[model samples]
Target: MTHRQVMEALSGLLLGLFVAVLSSTVVSNALPHILTDLHGGQSAYTWVITATLLTLTASTPIWGKLSDLASKKLLLQIALAIYIASSALAGLSQNTGELIACRALQGIGAGGVTALAQICLAAMVPPRERGRYSGYFGAVFALATIGGPLIGGVIVDTSWLGWRWCFYVGIPFALAAILVVQRTLKLPVVRRTVRIDYLGALAITGAVSLLMIWITLAGKNYAWLSWQTAAMVGGGLLLGALAVVIERRAAEPIIPPDLFRYRTVALAALASVLVGVGMYGATTFLSQYFQLARAKSPTMAGLMTLPMILGLALASTVAGRLITRYGKWKAYLVCGTLLLAIGFGLLGTARADTDYGLLSVYMAITGIGLGLTMQNLVLAVQNTVPRNELGAASSVVTFFRTMGGAMGVSALGALMTNKVGHYLAENLAAAHIPAGRAVAGGGIPDLHKLPAQVVPLVTDAFGHGVGMVFLCAAPFALLAFVTVLFIRETALKTDQQG
Candidate 1:
């Protein structure tokens, strides 16, 4: 590819990747309002997110395979179209179920965008110069992540727009992304009637979905140790084992068994899993903490979160550059992991009484550590793998990280609800409200309309529950630190030849 060709194609890829990241995150601050206004409950909230993450995880590897077989540009446009259409449907939905279903469809599109963008970039850029460009992609990732909440906040707080606009707002961007890729993106054409590993894909999806469903439902529908957990988790594990058996024997596995043979891939995957655990679990809940516990409006909550985005932006760029310059990555990975653990542990202490400045400091530290660690982990894995396996390697690391986040969000969310529910029940009983009414079917209260006396109690209860989540999360961060320590330092490759 010529300079102009590569640059234009990469620009489109970055834009697509940026918008995909934006879709998942921008909805964070707006979710409580959006669901409540639709008369939905906590279950709706979980499904809305779970559906998207499920589809994203299941379809990502398939997209990577498709990009390897066909024209990347054509595949991207198709993905963008899917995202735009589903996003519009999601915005127009009248009920939680419809919104959840539509969001799943949107996630399928997003899965394609993420996988294809990275693979296409690898196809064009050599490994040596890839680090410099990787920094730019990292910046794009961080920027969208930061921008999503701020934009969501403004839209939700706008009287004329409200929460629906969160979905609608992306439609124009999706359209523009599609058009840009169509016009500027180019790739080598490959013609092949390659059959996908349909059975392997189905097995992996079924296994993952079953387990995630079980996790999402447990504690609420049944106890954590109930028969349902045993059945689903156990069955899920069995299916996963079968998937491994099949993939090892198949001609082409959706996730090849041999990729894990390299120790670096294993460690990077573990580190990614850790970052996902802390980043997704803690950052998402922070919005709830601020808006609900601190009595901040959605707009103000998003604004307050500016520190995290700022930190992410700074670290992603600077870390990428530093890696490019020094040719050493292990120290940064180790340091970033340690910092992430510290940040999350500190954030565990935040409560209603915590000052905004202190809160910002904790979140900034978390964001900085995450920004330094996440993308570089992928780079480390990519460097270790051969060019032919680039798509699979990248998607494998990305898939595992997202899987970690999915599980963390589900597990931690249940923990939060249970803890908060317990607190509210005790305090409400002390305040003479019936325990039954306090724990209502949903453990949700209409804050705007509640009796003045009950609001503080409820808010404090939520804060109490959330503060405990980070404490639970701290050990996982340490596990990640340990994993990163085992990754031996490797020189950064500056050339593009895979």
Candidate 2:
């Protein structure tokens, strides 16, 4: 493919990326209602989210390895097909279990969409052009991040179409993406026989699955120190150990070990994990906080999050362009991490009594910092790596980011549930109310349905939970700052390769 052809292909792929991200986030607002109507509880609602993350995390490396071995365009087409099929099935799901299963399948496809798009960008463009092109990727992510909730809210609030339409919303877009790919996304196929790493893949998936399940269930369905937790965590760790052995011995590993040999990559991976926790910990629950804690409608909640989204878009694009010119990303990464810490620290002061304007400022600060850091972190890694291993390097960082996100959501979720439960029990006892009768006791409650008297109790409890989580995640952001300090600055490369 010529330069012009590659850029055109990238444009088409980005639209597909927008669709994939939109599908994931657009239905988030309606999830609570979806689960409730399907006779599901908190765990089911979480699993609905968790299953997707788990599958995406596990399948990401597989897709990256495949991109190096076969046809990137063909793999992307297959991914879009899988997404469309899974989404349609999910829309028709009558039970939470069925829906969870379908979403998991959808996540596998989403992983392909994410992993291959990055690989394709690397295959077609040099690291320098990548910085500019990556701005487009960041914009797609921002657009989807913003649009998902707004559209979800509109669909959820529209009594005619209701929440189910949220599930169906992406079908047409997915089709369009597939058609676009077929028309515009052409590439030279990489020819070579490659092993699939089936055993390593299975073991890693199994290990991650076991750990995620344990994280989600422990301290809720069972005690944190229970036999189930012991069995799952222990077994998961053992499986992970086995996976490391397999990767070292395998001819072609799922994730190349040499990638970790570089200190920059190692630190970046760790930073990615921390960034994941700080980013997803609060951002994922922001809509819930607005709608449930503040009694805002879903549409209003979507509108309220616009500042954060806008800040993210502006910062990511501007920073990428600047980084391209200056070739100084490590400083931005450090500054971004500090901003993330400060943003969350300010957010830690949140309460039922705080105003929206103030909260938006804190959120925007976090968003801007995140915008500056998130895409650039990947750019830093991609810039530092050789052309041949770009897929593995990029996929590895992406994997940590996704994995950390899952961990953040699960761990913080557990914290929220526990804190809310304890606060409700204590306060109810003080007021001589029956703790069992308190409807919004454990975790964030459905604010729309809570009694007037209990609304304060629930919202305050949630605010405290959110604040506590920020307190926990702030240090992680700070850790990212420290890690960025150590990343050796390298000159940007402008030549296209391989």
Candidate 3:
């Protein structure tokens, strides 16, 4: 394909990518308002995010395997249709339970859109030339990440539009993507005997679901070492072992067991997991921090996060072009991971009263690191794998990254809840104030409704608790940095068939 053809095809793929990313992000800033309106607590807040990620993680490899066997364009459209329908249903949700259920359905579509977008790109572009295009993916991701919050914030703040618009806003864009895909995207389908690996899929999904349930509920509902934990953890491990066995013996495994034989695939998968943990776990709560801890309006919170998004956009575009020109990528990954660790470490010291200038600087560093690291990890795996295995290999890395994200968000959110609760208690006692209705209910507080005297305590508690979340995340970033260092660099294949 000529550059023009590639760009034309990508026009639709990127739009689909943008919609997938936007769905997850646009809700970030509005989550507080959504929770408050639904009469939900911190647990509900975490589950809303976790439900999407958990389903996305579980379904990614299945979608990837299906891409290898089916029509990429047709699959993409089906995913878009599912996303549009579920997103509309989500907007009509009357309770948090309904919202979470809808979000889970949305994730099933997102898994297809995100996994298939990259798989389709690999089908069109050579490994060596893919860096330039992958950069485009990163840019769209950054745009959606930045835009989602701003859009969500504005929608929430707008009385007529309300938070529901956040779910509805992406439908038109998704619909347009489907039309564009039908018009521009073209790929040759390989004919093969298709065998769906139902047992492997069921076992892996069950395993991930059990573990995620344990992670999300362990500390809050029961002690970590309790009987519920033992049963869930033990059951999850058994299911995971069963998945490995099923994969090894199955005619068509969802995750091919032999792929792990390549050191690049294994290391990239591990590093992606760590990156997801550090990136998603720590950053998911930033909007909450800005709103609850710093008392910024949702719109202002979105604006304040611009530095990070801009940094990501700039770094991805520049690094991608450089990689294409020079055909070297490891240095960028190394620097990005290092920067990620440093950024998380710096943010760990933040307080409610910390200067905005300093926070912006820290966020930018993190964003730059992510831009350099995330897509490149997938690119690295793609460069080394045969063209035939592209979907499974790419999805392997994506699946682990998303799984790490789900785990990080669930575990860290639980920790933040406990820490915030403890601090809120201590501070309230110190101030000789009884736990008011807002405080006692344990739901996310409406700052405007709180007593002026009690506001600072809530903010301070959130500030301290959120800081601890970043502190815990910093080590994972460092581990990712180390993991990337050991991946032996392979020259990207110029052959489009690679």
Candidate 4:
């Protein structure tokens, strides 16, 4: 494909990518409202998000494996179609369970979009020229990231539009992407007899599900050190061990184990996990922080996050262009990780009375680090591996990152719940308030319904918990920095290797 043809195809592809990313995040501001309406508690709230992420993580390798054997364009369309159907159905869900089920279905399509977008793009552009085009990819991601929250907030806050519209809003955009791709994307199909590793896929899925369940329920449903915890941890590890064995023996492995033999791929995968942990864990509760702790409206919460989005947009686009121009990426990775650590370190000081100006700066710093790190990590892996292995290699990095995000959210959420419970109990006892106070509800706290004296204490507890979450995230960022230091820099390839 020529430059003009690639860009034309990418036009449709970026839109498709945008829709996938938008659907994933558009619920951030609306989640509180959704859970409240469905009568869900804190665990339910975390699972709603975790369910989607878990499916996306588990299915990514399967989608990537199929991309190598099937028609890329056909697979892309099928994924989009699934997304459209699931999103529409999710809007009609009457309860949290239904919504979580729909979200899991939605994740099946998302897994394809997230992996195949890069795979399709790599087929069209060489690693060298990919940097120039990658800037556009970064821009699209930034746009989706920025737009999702704002749109979700607006829909959530609007009485008539409501949170349901957040699900419905992306359907048209997804449909449009399908049409555009059908017309514009022209890739040569490589037909081959595909042998999918079903056992490996199932094993990995079981492992991930068990691990996530353990993380979500450990401190709440059972003691972290109890027999239930031991059983879950043992089961998850046993399943993970089974997955490795299956992958090694499979005719065509879902995730090719040999790819990890490459030092750069191994290091990059590690870095991706750490980065995902810090990024997702720290940012997941920020909206709640703004709305619940600071008592801001949904729209106001989204608007307040603008500085972070702006920094992300600017850094990703700029970093991509510069990397393309200079053909050097190590500095950006190192600097970005350092900035990420510092960002989380500063954010750890957050309190109910934290200054907006200072918080914005911390968020922007973290955003800039993410913008530099997220896309570039995949690009680095793509540069080192063979094109035929692109699907597996790319998905491996993405798979771990998504797993990290799922784990981070579950762990941090459980931590916050315990911390909040402890803090609330302490404050209530000091104030001579009973344990049955309205503010003691475990789910999304409705501040307006609480007694005047209880509201401040509840908000302060949340603020303190959020601060601890960020503090816990800081060490992960530093670990990412250390891992990036060991990744050997390889020059970007100028010719397509496939």
Candidate 5:
């Protein structure tokens, strides 16, 4: 395919990518409103996000494997159809439980879309030229990141539109992407004997679900060292071990055990996990911080995050061109991870009183780091693997990244819950306010409804608790830096099967 033909096919793929990314980012600012409207607590809030990530993580490898055996274009369309239907259903959800279930369904589709997008892209472009195209991915991500919050905020804040519109808003874009893909995407279908490892998939899902439940519920519902913890943790480990065993013996494993033998693949997968942990875990709570602690409107909260998005857009585009021009990637990866750690560290010091200028600077540093790191990790793995293994190898990295994200959100959310509760209690006592007089439930409190004297305490608790969340995330980013440092760079193959 010529560059023009590649871009033409990519136009639809990028749109699909935009819809997938938009689904997640658009909900960030609206989540506070969504929870408040549903009368949900912190646990429910975490579950809302976790449900999607959990399913997306588990299903990604399945989709990737299927891509190897089927028509990529057809799979992409099916995924988009699933997304459109589930999203519409989600808009009709009357409660958090219903919403979470719908979101889980959405994840199945998102998993396919995410994995297939990269698979299709790799099929079209060789690794040497892929960098320049990957930059477009970063641009699409930036647009979605920049737009989702603002769009969601507006929809939620509008008296008539409501938070449900956030779910419905992406349907038109998704529909258009499907049409464009049908018209422009032309790829030769590769036929292979299809043998999905259902048992391996089930075991992986069960193990991840058990661990996620344990992470979310450990300190809140039971002591971390209690019998319940022991049972869940032990059970999760057993399931995980079972998954590994099943994968090793299966005719076609969802995640190929042999892929890990390659040092680049292994290190890249590990680094992706750490990056996901730090990035998803810490950034997930920023909307709450801006709204609950800083007392900003959802619209303003969206605007406040622009610096980060812009930084990401700029870094990804420039880095991609440079990598293609010079064929060196490790230096950018190393610098990007270093910047990630520094960004998280700086954000750790944030409180309700932190200046916007300073916060923007921190966010920009983080965004630039992400742009340089995320897609490049997959590019590194792709460059090393054979053409036939592209789908599996690429999805493996994404699978780990998303698995890390799910765990990060659950664990960090639990930590934030505990810290916030403690601070709220302490602040109430310090203010001579009775505990009973404070917000009575774990449901997110509306500052407008609180007594004037109590608002500052709630804000302070959230500010301090959220800061601690970012502080905890910094170590993970630092670890990612250390992990990627050992990845030996190889020149990208100019040929499809070099």
Candidate 6:
């Protein structure tokens, strides 16, 4: 394909990617309102996020495996359709339970978009040229990341539109993506006898579900060291082991285990996990911090996040072009990971009264680090793996990162909830107010509904909880840096190989 043709095809793919990413983030600012409207608590707020991440993590490999055997273009179209439909359905959800179900369905589509977009890019662009194009992907991601919250905030604050538009807003973009791909994107649809490892897929899904259940519910519903915890944890591990055994024996595994044999792939996978845990885990609650602790309007909360988005966009665009020119990437990876640790460390100190200027600097640092690390990790692995394994390799890294995100969000969310509740109880007790009454009647921590005297305590509880969440995530970011240090540098390939 000519350069023009590749760019043309990428238009649809990038739009699809933007839509997928947009869905993931658009709910962040509006979440406070959504949960309030639905009469949900902290646990419900976490579940709303977990449901989507869990499905996205579990279904990613299936989409990647299917990409290798089926028509990439058809799969992309199907995925977009799924997203469009699910988004519309999500907007119509009457309660938190319905919304969570729709979000999980939406994630199945997102998994496809995430896996297939990279696979198509790998098919069209060789490693040497991919960095430049990967920059565009990064740009779309940053754009979506920035725009999602802002748009959702606007919709939520608007009387006529409300938060439902956060879900509905992505439909048009998804449809446009489908039409563009149908018209422009083309790839060889290799026909072969296909064998899907359904059993392995089931085991993997069950294992992930079990683990997330444990992570989200351990301290709340059951003791951390009790029989329930042991049962769930033990069951998840057993199923995961069974998945490995099944994958080894299957004719076509969802995740090809041998991909990990390459040192670069192994290191990249580890880095992806660490990056995901720190990045996704800590960032998920930023809006909550702003809304609950700082008492910012959703729109203001969205705007406050702009520094980080700007940093991400700038770093991704500049780093991509530089990597293309220099054929060197490890320095950026190392620098990015180090900065990520530092950023989290700084953000961990934030409290209800944190200066916006200082917080912006910390957020920008984390964003730059993410821009530098996220795509390049995949590039490093892609450079080492053969073209036939591109889909699987790309999906593997994405799968782990998402799985890490799922785990991080679940675990950290639980911690945040407990901390907030603890602080609230203590403060309420000191004030001679019944903590249970305040908590039981309160839904989703709206400061406006609380007595003026109690507002300060609630905000402090949230602020401290948010800070602790980031503090917990900082070590993971540091570990990512450590993992990247051990990765052996592999020169970028100049020639296309298939």
Model 3: which residue pairs collide? none
State the C-alpha lDDT per candidate. Answer: 0.80, 0.80, 0.92, 0.88, 0.91, 0.90
Q: What is candidate 3's lDDT per residue for 161-269, written digit by digit as tens?
A: 9999999999999999999999999999885787989899999989989998898888878999999999999999999999999999998799999999999999999
Off by over 4 Å in 2: 1-7, 440-444
Tally clashes: model 3: 0
TM-score of each: 0.96, 0.96, 0.99, 0.98, 0.99, 0.98
Which lDDT tens digits does candidate 5 get at residues 130-221?
99999999889899989999999899889999999999999999999999999999999988886899899999999999999999999889
* Candidate number that wins on TM-score, 2 or 6: 6
Model 5 error, position 139 (Å): 1.4
Candidate 4 collision pairs: none
Q: For residues 445-466, write the lDDT of model 6, one tens digit per residue.
A: 7788888888888898889889
Model 3 scores a C-alpha lDDT of 0.92
- How far in Å is the alpha carbon of 298 misplaced in model 1? 1.1
For residue 258, model 5's alpha carbon misses the true position, in angstroms, by 1.0
User: What's the residue-level lDDT of 160 in candidate 6?
Assistant: 95
Candidate 1 Cα misplacement greater than 4 A, ranges: 1-6, 435-439
5 against 6, candidate with superior lDDT: 5
Poorest 10 consecutive residues by lDDT, candidate 2 = 436-445
Report residue 101 deviation for candidate 2 (angstroms).
Answer: 1.2
lDDT of 2 by residue, 1-498 (tens): 676887778777887788778767876677766766787765676677777778888998888888878888889989888988998899899998999999999889888898888888887777776777787788788898899988988998889997878878887887888888888876788667978898999989989888888888788789998899999999999999999999888887888788888787888899998898888776667766776567777777888888888888888888878877776677778888999999888887877678888988998998888887888888888877787778788888888888888777888777766766777677677767776555532433566666667667767766676677777788888888888889888877778553
- TM-score (C-alpha) between model 1 and the true structure: 0.96
Off by over 4 Å in 4: none
Candidate 1 residues 1-498, lDDT tens each? 776788887888888998888888788888878877887776676677778878888888777766666787888889989999999999998988899999999999998898888887777776555666677887888788778888888898889988888998888888888888888877667756766787888888889888888888898898889889999999899889988888888777888789999999988887777777777786678878887788877778878887777787788788777777777777777877887888888888987778888988988987788777877787888888887778788888777777777777777887888888888877888899865544356734567766777788788887888888887888888899899889877776656555
